[model samples]
Target: MSGAMRMLAGLYRPVESQTPYGGRSVTFEAMGSAWLACGARRRSERGEGDEHHAVETMSAETRDDPRLETGRVLRFGGADWGIVTVRPLRPGRVGLELERRR
Candidate 1:
């Protein structure tokens, strides 16, 4: 598999966890571009709490599809971080599928 695919595939592995709400599937996406690293957390239906992570939406010309972009801001930690194009691959699978310019 390609480097990008390998990174995503590794992250897609099923993980077991328990939250205050209840037990739910662990779904998350992470990507690194240059010196930036961003990620997003999917909400678990089993839990009533709001998802802590947030994402954005974007459209691509080469790829005619919509995707969710996850990101956040942190001043204390370091530079501002942001997510750019996140899309669902299937029912319970999602990840980044864009090329970042250097």
Candidate 2:
């Protein structure tokens, strides 16, 4: 199970989170990354969310990592996004629910 995940590790984007070091200072730390499978969760029988877009699309599958915690800001590609859920899938893997910070 875990071996399957390891096979795809190279596909994941590296994400980082900053840790405060002192006054007005911080240090960047690696929070790892996951292969994101992006998609829009449909609101109804149609296909995608047409009206209520604020309700996040729910079907983003990601490579499971333990560090993917809710409320943590992960920096990806020079942008930061907040984690909404870190769901455990099979052993050694987790699904990450993320939302862009405003």
Candidate No. with top TM-score: 2
Instruction: Estimate candidate 2's alpha-carbon lDDT, on a 0 to 1 scale.
Output: 0.50
**Each model's TM-score?**
0.22, 0.44
lDDT for each candidate structure: 0.31, 0.50
Clashes of each: 2, 1
**lDDT tens digits by residue: candidate 2, 2-101:** 3222212222233445547533433445555566554443333323557433333243456566556676655544445566777877676567665652
Model 1, 1-102: lDDT tens per residue?
122212111111223578888867663443222211223323223324774433332222112122234432111122232334556555644544332211
Candidate 2 backbone collisions, by pair: 64-94
Candidate 1 local distance difference test against the native: 0.31
